[model samples]
Target: MKQGIQAFISYTYTKNDVWLITMKDMMQWVKNPIENSHLTKGYWICQFNDKIKCSEQTSNSTTKKVTFAAIINVDQIWIWQTAFLVVLYIVIYRYDKYMQEKKKK
Candidate 1:
């Protein structure tokens, strides 16, 4: 909605020996005007292999509708993170104000 860049980082460890970390930049590219080019398209960033390589599709891209399950899964993480940071900031601000008041008195 806002005219800016956003970075999204997420990790999913379904197996004991493997970890999948996904990072996406939420910015529309001039290359893909039809669809959101940043969508994952149900693919992992990497796999357990000897030579790990990541690829990007710069052409012939189609609009991928986000699934409800995916929305719920990712939104929960951001919601909790944002709430915690907001609360932390409020607490710190209040403490600083109280300290200043005590010094003034």
Candidate 2:
């Protein structure tokens, strides 16, 4: 059971001590220049980090931090795609039911 569970939620930190539930945290960590330079080695992650690093100065204000967080949220493509799939499923299910009812009438 432990192995099975780990297979699904296996994303880990540098130390392997901390377990993260979302990719957003990983994305944020990858963007940090000092904290985890090793992670930026990946081509895609590096590109994403470069794109999201909107501000030049390292010391960002509260508003800038919030904006950065929002940008990260938006950049999480899988989350948006999953949400769209769920909505599409619901619409298709409802439409199927409506069609069945119309056929009965």
lDDT on C-alpha atoms for all candidate structures: 0.33, 0.31
* Regions more than 4 Å wrong, model 1: 1-75
Give the total clashing residue pairs for model 2.
0
Pairs of colliding residues, candidate 1? none
Tell me each candidate's TM-score. 0.30, 0.30
- Model 1, 1-105: lDDT tens digits are 322212232323223232222222222322232253233333323221222233332233442322111112242555534543443344335445555665699
Task: Name the lDDT value of residue 31 in candidate 2.
Answer: 44
Backbone clash total, candidate 1: 0
In angstroms, the error of model 2 at 44 is 30
Which has the greatest TM-score?
2
Model 1: per-residue Cα lDDT at residue 45: 33
Distance from true position, residue 14, model 2, in Å? 58
Give the range of the ten consecutive residues with the poorest summed lDDT in model 1: 63-72
